[model samples]
Target: MSKVFDFSGVDDFCSGGFMHTNPKDSNLFFPLGRHVDVYFPRKRSHVSAPFVFSGEVKPQPSIEVLPDECLFEVFRRLSGGQERSVCASVSKRWLMLLSSIHRDEIFPAKGNLDPEEHDNTSISVKEDEAFKPKEKVEFVDSERVKSVNEEFEGIDSDGFLSRCLEGKKATDVRLASIAVGTGSRGGLGKLSIRGSSSTRGLTNLGLRAIGRGCPSLRYLSLWNLSSIGDEGLLEIASGARLLEKLDLCHCPAITDIGLIAMAMNCPNLMSVTIESCTNIGNESLKALGRYCPNLKCITVKNCALIGDQGIVSLFSSAGHVLSKAKFQALDISDVSLAVIGHYGSAMTDLELLDLQNVNDRGFWVMGKGQGLQKLKVLSITACGGVSDSGLEALGGGCPNLKLFGLRKNLLVSDTGIVKLARAAVSLESLQLEECHRITQCGVFHILANCGGKFKALALANCLGIRDINFLFPLTSICHSIRSLIIHNCPGFGDVGLAVLGRMCPKLTQVELSGLQGITDTGLLPLIRSLEAGLNKLNLSGSVNLTDNSVVAITKMHGETLELMNLDGCKYLTDITLSEIAQNCSVLTELDVSKCGITDSGIATLSGAEQLNLQIFSLAGCSFVSDMSLPYLGVLGKTLVGLNIRHCNGISSSSIDLLLEQLWRCDVLY
Candidate 1:
């Protein structure tokens, strides 16, 4: 009789005494007393329909369900991963709905789900015509699919199926292979398999499917992913246990057992970029100082088997949490400069130190005093072993130095730029590109004492800079020069462009590329006193600039321009780019490379609609073609980095409509 397990008609029902068909009937009563429904069912239920009590049949209104915080707001809109498997296949009341949520907010613990849930399960199994795939496998494995459509001729159609399934997934392909299967390819938290290096047979199955699907991957970029190796980087240091930024730049089949399996499995690795790997030496810097103890930043560039015992085991193990180090600028020319002069005085918050091709015993071990006053950007380019006593020991030890790049440091002359401009008085940006034994007395001692806190002054190819008289002591002593790059200075002309238009009146960026003795009377009075503090203007290869100096500098400062580089100037034409698109309405980056304009100078830059342009370089302009790409797609919807490299009369269908009107471009060289 106990078989009548009635949950009191179940609405939040509660009852304990069940499963007892009278186990030996030990007076637990329901045996005969109270007439336990007389030991059974008179048709299972008392179908008592005769009572006809019109208002008392109210037993169906028991729906007080929505509890678990309203089932977690319907599991936070069915928490991703294909809407939680389409809300767990919508049934069994949403499979007990969000069965206790929190599994990293319903998935995405690296791969398995979220890649927009494997592209919404490959567009719902390609619109499931009875779960598709009994065919579609032509990505490699051919001899059919019409010889894979003739090896996809000149390819297209997503690059011949992404070069024959580079996303590999076909083993008996189940239901369109569940979004690149193997649990939808591992956790790619920050995995950027850059330039896949011609994928040599799926590079160890994409590094063992990202170490068995991103086990909570933590930033891993195999930059040149050259057929990865060392057993797929020891299966990514034993499956990325929360790795932390590791970029194997030119991954030449990694060595040192993948840096001893990422120093015995990524111990909270911070940043490690083996630039030109070169089989990492010094036992991978003593196994990254015995397992990345919070390594800060280490970039071993052109690693010729890193010397100085791998920079003294990387500054004796992460030189106090190294704030950033890029060695192999010729391995500090075989370490000296007192072995980084006492580790650069204990690297007190080192802020970028690239001893490029270091010499002079690593610049007298980085000029003795080590603590480079909290160095702020110092690059000794082509460090012919620095001279003038390592630029007077880095201008008396980096006094809050502000960017000092000594390019091609051929024994930096002018008494090492007047003792690094009298000990860098907080020099604000100084790059003596191609130093060529600097002259004009170290350019008038940094335009007379750091030109009032100069802001960028690159004397490119400094041929003992001929006069405009150091631009009148750099515009009356650096009136805070906002970027003034003098490329191939040819001793500047127009009397140094009218003494840089009377001492840079707050010059807003200017580069006189190859100044062939500036003309137009020094760019028409320096564009009428830099027409209201210009805004980026570089007359590339200014072959004595013509077209009346670009129509008198776009007629008095083309509406306060915004980035304009007339590359190779070539006697400017097209009426000086249609008077700079009718008075440059705030131009936005325009480089007329090798200009000889055509297509009517891109139809006067399609009437530069208020020039809201965004990076447009007509590389080596060959009289524009492809009919000037539909007028450069009306400035390709606010472009972004579009350099029509070698514009040999544009074709390839004008780069497919300039990549469909620069669809949010990111560098289309």
Candidate 2:
């Protein structure tokens, strides 16, 4: 023994877990067993712990004399950044050795560093995957998870697999695995992280590895991730220079620093969606405006710090190139709207929702700004400022506008509707919902003034609309209309339906759900008036309707009918199902939930000659029993989905039997 070097107790140095050394254990110092302090950066705040090396050492030896393998283990044992930094600064060789140690070996990943072990679809989030941390999970997409490896030579553009990690799967080990495994392939292109564990999951370490390895990443989405902050995003901005689209939601830890850096670094960025990010404000938006000239789509919602300054700066620089923009629940007032209207020459779609600060004057100014020449679709909801004058001005401002939708705006009435309709010559469709002031006259004016080009109309929850204004009958009243949806209109009765049936003869796709005012008297005439059979029909929650309406619709539109929903029509019986089975041969979907249909109705439809139905739902049909199981099983050849959820009469054994019979069907019992 030349220097009495004791390397036998080397494993004791790894007392601390994967990402951090045990602050209370002094074994990390190894031969130099002296009391020390350690810090964990992932905690966000500076958190330190004192290590008490109370035990006496058998033989004290210099750490500089340790072998390469011993040094490798020691370096690998140190989890957090501070410890690694402290070690690396000691010498150049230590720094190189520390850099050489891979994250997967240190963190102990679930997947091995090989092609077979890597799950191209997903990755883990915890440091010690073997430790098995509990995490709350959101939807994990398994789309194209099974790789179809059409191998060519070295790294094709589509060679690397797009990964989606959520819950426990979003671990640093998995990120390390993806970094190491997919780098040889074309590198990770797209990644999504949705919802993490109750405790913190992903940190800067994972993103750092991703930065070094998957530099070619293009699209990224992060949702409900509280642990990730500026450092993690900074790493992404530094490496993924070619990134085009980024969507961040409910990530409170990420502030303007991260967003500004990303905007500055990735000049080719095209689309960005920022929702409920409290820390993000004008600085980040200003950076995007100054740096990202190629920005096309921008949606900023529920960010308290964002104001008119941010919106003005963004639209002033990049609005001409933008195709779509949505601003919701922001602090911005009329100034932002005016700036957007002034610069959004190329924008085709725009939405303004829940904006409390902007008033009627602001809306008027935006309309008269005369810059949104190419705007096609516009939706305004829950805004205080959208009045009749503003609507009138907007009609003249956006001449090319094809579709206009208004929701929860109480100030708009018949005057605004008629004025907008007359001025907006290119308008083809109009949708109004929860707009209490919109009377029948407003709807009538839209149809009359839209110059017979109006093809679609949807009216829902408008208590004031006592049907259309038949008193002032215009010649061109929805003559070209094909799709119509009127629901929850308490004032609408048979007279209204009769009027619509006569006016809109070309109606094909119709949904009149939640309308207790109308029965077969109004509906049957509409079916008879159609030039061609209806393709889709939904009469859900129309409890007043019976077999009369169902039988008439099935017989009239039998050939063209593809989908039907008669849910909550408790009066419907086996007769309705018999008509659907016998008449609607090409029907692909049918829902009769909460109906009075018994097993006989289901049995009759199950044995149809060419029912050809793919999706069938009998949920809440208490009359349906186990007797319909075998008959439903016969539909396995063509049926892809079956729902018998609330049928208390059917036993679990019968459901199991039906499951055994139907191999391809997705049965929900």
State TM-scores per candidate. Answer: 0.33, 0.77
Q: After superposition, how far is residue 301 of candidate 2 from its true place, in Å?
A: 1.2
Of candidate 2, the 10-residue stretch with the lowest lDDT total is: 144-153
Instruction: State each candidate's clash count.
Output: 13, 7
Residue-wise C-alpha lDDT for candidate 2, range 560-649, written one tens digit per residue: 999999999999999999999899988999999999999898888887988898998989999989888778877667889999898999
What's the lDDT for all of these models? 0.61, 0.78
**Candidate 1 Cα outliers beyond 4 Å, as residue runs:** 1-182, 186-218, 221-238, 241-262, 266-286, 289-311, 315-362, 365-378, 381-387, 391-404, 407-510, 513-519, 522-537, 540-547, 551-575, 579-669
Worst 10 residues of 1 by lDDT: 170-179
RMSD of 1: 19.4
What lDDT tens digits, residue by residue, belong to model 1 across residues 1-669? 243433333233333343445544623433333333222222335545432211222234322255657755655454344344333333323323333233333333343534554442233334323322244333223322211111111312221121123222221121111212222222235545555566443455445544643455666766665667788777767766678777777778788777778777888888887877777777887788667878777767777776677677667666656666656443644353455445543343332234555555556556555555666766655556668877777667767767777776667687777677677787788778777778644665566566367677778887767763443433345567677788886876786667656656567778888888787877777677753557778888887677887777666667787888888887776777788888888888888888778887777778777778788887878888888877777777787777888888888877876786767775454
Error of 2 at 558 (Å): 0.8
